[model samples]
Target: MPAAIALARQLSDADNKGIRLDSASLTEPGTPAEAFAVQRETLALNGWLTAGYKVAIRPDGSSVSAPMAHITHASTSGTAGFDRPAVDALEVEICFVLGKDLAPRNTPYTRETLLDHVAAIYSGVEFLGHRLDDGSRSPALLFLADRLGNAGYVLGEELPAKVTEPGQTYPLTITINGDAVFEGPGKHPNNDPVAAFLLFANALTEPVAKGRIITTGSLCGAIPTPPRAAIAISGFTTLTVTAASTRED
Candidate 1:
């Protein structure tokens, strides 16, 4: 097997079995580009469908994009359930629902062009996880190859289009299992979540289908949670996830 595919399989198998890859056993990607290729192959190997993307801009202004699987959706019943060792942390975010397909073209898409295709704006929570034992301290390329530590996502209520305006800050409060965890003002790093969406759209080498949802980077940094937790985002929405312990039988 190719190194990339072999790495993908190792990661995928670890995920399925609720185990972590030994740091020493991981095959590091040769380059940043190769890491992304490994990510693509990983998705294919697991037969996971690309539902959307998670976009983030580094402090240096460089952007990163990762594909989100269809399984990312959490139930509206104010709960998101995961198996033990599957989810590591949670991030608050803003999500955009696309109303039209954006196919790859010679002409890049602008913020306005991207917004024109948006059907709605939403409050969102991104689930973070990793298959490697020492993923956080791994090389940048290896981290990228691990899907940027993304495990899943939970979309909250639809917000008025006007609320998504650049620089607008939303007062956010997060509680896990009824205990207040994070309370602060949440805003896009670039002041415009739409612009982040546009960046991801334009950078895509493939077409994005209608109804796909793209989530901007975290409003608050990734926060840790318990196995069975209730996450509430005051003034927006609430979600819950029970990370059931895996059975070794």
Candidate 2:
């Protein structure tokens, strides 16, 4: 895992210095397993606490995940405690909070059993950013190692009802700075809200304690956003972003 350690150091250093890495500078991992190794190292280097997880599955059935460090309430802190680089975009999503421990076991967790483990469903937003320059063209594995471009997660109000099954849809309207940026019905990218969660459940090597959150893939993809924007998503509480400042050195 030396490569993972080296890449993790580069990522952590870039974040500390408020700089973006050129893709060429990365000693990119060769496989998904190696990429996740880099993720573990990066989290260790940054001393970040794992509050939740975010995941997305690729078309090939392989998946990438990020351990979230910052989980905040939209009603109280908004994005004030987000400590990543500049905000790039916000992804509207559904967050499932665990009500029970899911430990590693021999048997797979079925969809029915998994839904029974959820404590609540809440409207959620994923703060997206990258340590790599423009991150779009960077290697997929590198992006995965960078915690799936997750800067933070903001928890909105709880839904009045529960989503007991997958493939549910919701009417979503996102307003930024009092202007409507996106308004439409939103569905999970994979068409199932629990698809990522299922993948996450089966892949865990450690126990996910009760109260840890699992945010599924973006419902409407990433919405380009500016710093310090007041964002309001229909059926959820409003959240304001903290202005991302750059170092002048």
Give each model's whole-structure lDDT.
Answer: 0.74, 0.76
Off by over 4 Å in 2: 76-83, 236-249
Backbone clash numbers for all candidates listed:
4, 0
The CA root-mean-square deviation of candidate 2, after full C-alpha superposition on the true structure, stands at 2.6
How big is the positional error of residue 231 in model 1, measured in Å on the Cα after superposition? 1.8
Pairs in steric clash, model 1: 78-240, 79-240, 80-240, 80-241
lDDT of 1: 0.74
lDDT of 2 by residue, 1-249 (tens): 888899989887876676678888677789888988888888888788888999778778865578887788765544433445556778888888899997877898888888778888877888876788857568888888888877788887676544525567777888877898888777778888788888878887889889989998877888877655677677434445443425322
What TM-score does structure 2 among the candidates reach?
0.89
**Model 1: per-residue lDDT, tens digit, 42-124?**
89988888787887765566667777874445665666655545677788888988899978778888777778888888777
- Once model 1 is optimally superposed onto the true structure by TM-score, how far is the C-alpha of residue 85 displaced, in angstroms? 4.7
TM-score of the candidate numbered 1?
0.88
